[model samples]
Target: MRTDFWKKTAAFGLQDDAVNILSNAADYKSQVLEQIAKAEQRIIITALYLEDDDAGREILAALHQASLTKPNLKITILVDYHRARRGRIGESKSEGNAKLYCEYNEKYNSNVKVFGVPIKAREIFGVLHLKGLVFDDILLYTGASINDVYVQQHDRYRLDRYFVLNQKGICDSIESFMNEIMLVSAATPRIDSRPIADYSEIKLAHKQLMRTLKKTKYKEPRASNKNQLSARMFLGFGRRGNDLNKLIKNLFDQTKEELVLYTPYFNFPAPLMRSLRKLLKHGKKVTIVVGDKTANDFYISPEKPFNTIGGLPYLYETILQKFLKSHNKYLEQGLLKVYIWKDNDNSFHLKGVCSDSKRHLLSGHNLNPRAWSLDIENGILLDDPNKTLEQRIEAEKVQILKHCIQINNYDELETMSDYPAPVQKILGKIKRVKGDIILKRFI
Candidate 1:
């Protein structure tokens, strides 16, 4: 099949509607609750991680309460099966959020359903990392998972982007994609079945899901008269049959002016990096907004005195430093711009990129080896040249920038050693350890 065929099929007509961009967890909670209260038909959610943390429980409680009042309100939650079974770094056994969610459905609420999809075996190179919520004809997309930090349950927060749109065509197409491609696939099993955690079963289900994904055809759904917005969805997998990769290539190849990207991690696949260099060499304006080492991370190992489970911050900072060192001339010439996020006590976890201020991409796909090789990711493409989506993007950019301390010159970077005293000491100790390969996976 030709690549353009899929691209054309995905690029359907849309109508104009008001777009709302939410900046933090507090805003997200308000918006989600508001939508749930008004929902008349159904609520569809997809998340990478859904822990049984305070925030997660609160959301579940709210949903349950809403269902009690509005018995007809149907809710479906799709999360990663593998994540559901595995415990966090310091936790023992699963808190059983998935199981609890299932029980809630079976016992008290007849209108709610939860499903888990294991993506590691399903897409050997990727895992399911998309986060979205669809209610009636409205869609909410974000890069946050269900946790206290993600929703600002206590004092801490996780930096992310939240967007709302009421485009009927886009909403309907995404809903269909969830139902036809995800719900029907073997990778996704009904939570009520009490699926076992066997490697063989996971592998089998993965193969089945891949087969279905390969054969599935996605076309832009016909727009209803009430529709008001134009959007497109893109996936990133498969080798020769992967239309998502082609779509990304086309976006870069066809860009005439500028590209702006927002990703928590800074590492890029070889081809993507080459494409970025090519764009820079061609004098195109490129702005990359990434999370600073400390702010972009997830866990800070309190046990090890400043060690972190995820090496996101270190990896991203190293990549940025290397890129700047290699492309010093480009930096001086104003062809490249890099911004880092550093909220007071928050962590940054949003992902996706926008190109030419006309195209927008949103997903949970962090730009790192873990995301590329072990997580499934999904994002949407929107051509918004009229600045319709600028409000949300700009607001997030500004808020994130507020927490960052800029490193504009190589001289500044060389002298920048203002890490927390404890972190600085920890970094020094880590550099002394020679055989610390085990730390790479978790860090």
Candidate 2:
């Protein structure tokens, strides 16, 4: 049943034998390093940002070492331009990731090039939120950046999906997209002494490139996947430009039995909310797995001094409470499941959707308003209409739920009074001023 659906849906091709779903971040990092060491021809990595930390240095060192051995190896990394040169909001001024790139050029002399791509003029409005790592003929897709927490180099880890795809069509398409589209754009290859003013000089070209990318879709020779599995790539930006959004909503509308959503952030765009409401009304099963408030990356301990961003988890919790309240009937009947992921001091950044037993969305898109209308997002849709990967998907779900606890009632979430003094005071002000609505739309 699903095999036919995938045949009809996939624009390109998918290989069943080549798909490998990894267990966790530590495992993912090891595999990535191994692949990097073995890559012979080229290595391309794209992510939101790459920090200059222990893990980041380790990744760069591996790439440089590989280039030293395979002197002909081509390595290119792309990170958000505005984000690459800026420090954290409250942190003291320092040379950001770009400086590290410059140092690698001078010290390693291994021909590893890091490019900065600005999806929009500034960081607040938009960014280069792309995700993929192409090593020779293999493509590694994850929502994680090369950082200490994301790579799980320490006790703290950010939970995310790690999917490995090894198909000629998939590899070629991604490589072509990087070489022809991203590299040709206004992406800066060297920013050693370049000023922000100089970077902004290419703003018009960047805008034009984004427009072109909005209209561009990966084109490759279509082939029937082995074992009846099919996959397609989708990219989008802004509200209407997002094909991933459209694909997810279509999955919701098409779901016959069950739907599962895994997002670190709890917020959902209006369209998804409407589809979910309709699905629930039709007596379909819906499960939402999200990070606990404490697991939010922005969550600071109540004992710590409050930063304005620290209140984000509370705001999301308030929204979840309202959602649960409005859909209490679904909860009572066991048609709705909400699981909150928490693992001590670890955090979460999972994002994907599974519909019924066939279609799975592996993506970096958070499914939030910001992702829907602001950032450049991309993902690959694996439609296994024949249920070829059912066991794998189910196993992945179990892994994700290992540290999660389901919410039986909305009362599990703390109210304003139960929050820390600073969080309570801050949320109280936002609620009074009706600023929560704005934050929902933007954050």
- 299 Cα displacement, candidate 2 (Å): 0.4
Q: Across residues 358-424, which tens digit of lDDT does each residue of candidate 1 receive?
A: 6777667665445543555567766575867667677777876787665565444421255445544
lDDT of 2: 0.84
What are the lDDT figures for the candidates, one per model? 0.67, 0.84
- For all predicted structures, in order, the TM-scores are 0.85, 0.95
User: Which candidate should be chosen as best, given TM-score against the real structure?
Assistant: 2
List clashing residue pairs in candidate 1. Answer: 15-228, 15-229, 126-375, 126-376, 127-375, 127-376, 128-376, 129-376, 311-443
TM-score for candidate 2: 0.95
